[model samples]
Target: MTDRPTDLSSPPTPQPVRRSLLSARKFALMASVVAGLGAGLYGFSPAPDHFNVLSTAAHAQVNNEVRKVAQPVGFADIVERVKPWVISVKVNINEKVAKNDDSAEDSPFQPGSPMERFFRRFGGPDGMPPGLRGGRGGRGAVTGQGSGFFISDDGYAVTNNHVVDGADKVEVTTDDGRTFKAKVIGTDPRTDLALIKVEGGNNFPFAKLAEGKPRIGDWVLAVGNPFGLGGTVTAGIVSASGRDIGNGPYDDFIQIDAPVNKGNSGGPAFDTAGEVMGVNTAIYSPSGGSVGIAFSIPASTVKTVVAQLKDKGSVSRGWIGVQIQPVTQEIADSLGLKKADGALVAEPQADGPAAKAGIQSGDVITGVNDQPVKDARELARTIGGFAPGNSVKLTVIHKGQDKVVNLTLGQLPNTIEAKADVDRGDRGDATRGSDIPRLGLTLAPAGSVAGAGKDGVVVTEVDPKSPAAERGFKEGDVILEVAGKSVASPSEVREVLAAAKTENKNSVLIRVRSGGSSRFVAVPLAKG
Candidate 1:
């Protein structure tokens, strides 16, 4: 604000004091007023009008600033509507204990006791001392509690998987203080989402999933059982979208700067219209309290996961059997991609869905089922959400050409087990003889080398001017396996070649291990 001068230059001209102070005549006016009063008009100001004008201008400026701020919207109404459905989940975990009893042999609980025989024969009193019980000694249970909220009017509440994990009993308290026993529906550990049914009784007000969902910058309210303190509400904006905090493979969390505490998880974050926008999941704080950095699982994601869990007792996501890595700027430049984007196919597992679909290494997966894949991790999570046998449309860019491939997805292998030979840098359990000979060295048998290290056996020496030498063979070329047999000794290679020669073999499949990596190669046998 501009400083007000003592003179009346800007003051109203009608005031006699303003007229004098503006011209430096106020001093004379004050003396004249004192003389006219005779007793001295002591506290009166001759320049009150000048001060009044400045005061009026300041009031107008303050009112104009007030008009700039839009009226505040209160969350009290939202809390009142949704609080009754948001419950404090108390999980009592009773971990099973192992017990051992140690007592005197004379006691009935002990073996070979006369009292035990008597009780067995004629229902006699136990020989154990009064108030002494026989039971195992070294075990106990630990208990923990957290919160959750109803996702449906039917009392289907969602909470963190950890809250109810290993829980013996789970009880929920409504905002109005009514308690109910809840039964677990299902839990997805990868997503940390748990579904529980409260056996919901009577009419309950459940928050609806937000329409159009929550966008960044939208106002939101976090209602939860904070600090186990029952029904606390805090407010913030949607700070970010799609954050991966490394909690799990499917960690697309919506970040918010709201007040959340220890027990606040499993609660609902309501958008401005009092609709459920997300489930409060985690907070980032060194002190473990509200530092305004919290995250929530988007309601859209939870809705799909929860419904699947309810229908199947577990969620089965699509799995395209291919491991992936993020595309770096270096990799992008090497691939001649203008911008660094899309997931890089690191290693395509053999016999997996991706390989069956002809998805090979060096191909970039741009989209999955028509959805743009942002990163390798997100793509993994997306594919993992589908059932193993569900077919998918994959959009891939190979050699600068975008193509959509339709693949018949197969059931994911329970676990991928792969092979190698020791005859030459190989891995396996069997061996054979080779009739088509290039190197003058004769084949020999190698004992099975199973459960071997990454490094396989190497050829002690190679003949000059031979096909083996032409193919870059040398001394110390470790033989992992030949024809899928684990060869431990050099003689095993002869056994393997001998068998291959019986079929007039043209090629020998060998697994060679060198430099800490195992690779399978088909070595063509040359005519002797």
Candidate 2:
């Protein structure tokens, strides 16, 4: 029938069962061959030792020198050890008084500024919740919470200065949920540290400060009262050290990545060893919450400030009595210094210790007591570290000459104003402006100008496009000194400029006095 007309389109189906049996037989043969090979390899391989699973022969092909790393478990042990020492501090502050009182200085940050937000004192009146703030015209006393830890057995504890500042009543609740009335022993506003004495306890659990500085990347545990939640714990690492956040002159804060929030101020950041690494004081936040950037006063600073606060009710720091600025490369080049370092004396205060010890405005303080002065801030911190009336040997670079001046530091006053400002009176018809060669300045004698004092030449006009203007010279700026020499007339400045050019100097250093302060400017000497 298939050959009759051809169902030629359909192929023949033949021996399906036989083909299947052949394929099964071939797969079975391949399986047997693989099994035989595996058995042979197993017979040649050495048997694993039951007693010594990690023997040398077992790992002969592996690199034994590779270190096996494991993840850290958790900070639970550290938290358990240090949690007993943490306390929640409650302060009753009159919001109306805190807003108007001079106690605002107790806070390093302003009340309503962005820095206030960045470094907001958690227990301060502004840091409290809106509901907790005074309800009726903001005139009632409001309560706020902060964090603190006991430092001694006799109920002596450490908290933030802002926490106890202007407090009508101070109280602390321990980890055990017991509240005690505490009194502020002392407070240091400069460092924002405070010492308080908790009543009704003689033997309390305490925490020890870490002996050395916490290294960056070291695991840290922050224990505190965050958002009124007592004994809250967060984990992170030490982000940095010696950070200056413009808090104050002595702003050597340890930056941490711990999630510290409001009410965490005055808390303790502990190391893995359960020792206090720093006291959490401020946080850098844009939305008024922790963004993983928090600042703490290092244990070193806390030790020093707390010691002083414990001794007396106030803190006194050493002051050199000089207005200083960082030494820039331009200033170094103009002054023939090989390296730009140390602090430049912008102006030594009148009758100040630095002025009395022969320190001049043009001098550069290179070192203090044999230690290098890193910058203006370092010099301030170094001097402040010493007690008042302490003798200090200052290495100074005065007018290109290196000299050591021995001076006793004075007590930093509660209120130390910055450098005095120059009184630039009404720019009446000053003397006709005179031009200096290669300098874009129209100068006039200070005595000829009505409001300008008779100490230096006054800048009648500055070419907006000139090097002088670019160097921060303003029309009313008084040129106090040119090339280390005081100038009273335009001719004196010209003479100094000519002399500097003759000496093949690329720039001339001039001390300029502006509205309220004096600073040195290095003006480039354009070639004729």
Q: Give the TM-score of candidate 2.
A: 0.78
Backbone clash count for every predicted candidate, in the order shown: 61, 1
- Candidates in order have lDDT scores of 0.64, 0.80
Q: Report the C-alpha lDDT of model 2 over 37-151, residue by residue, as the tens digit.
A: 7769887532455213333332331222121112337777778888999999988866534465545433434465434543454334444421122222245555667899999
lDDT of 1 by residue, 253-350 (tens): 89998787667778888887777888886666554446787778888788888888899878777667676667666456545567667787754777
350 Cα displacement, candidate 1 (Å): 2.6
Superposed model 2: Cα runs more than 4 Å off: 1-71, 95-138, 418-425, 435-442, 460-471
The TM-score values for the models, in the order shown, are: 0.60, 0.78
Output the worst ten-in-a-row residue range by lDDT, candidate 2. Answer: 61-70
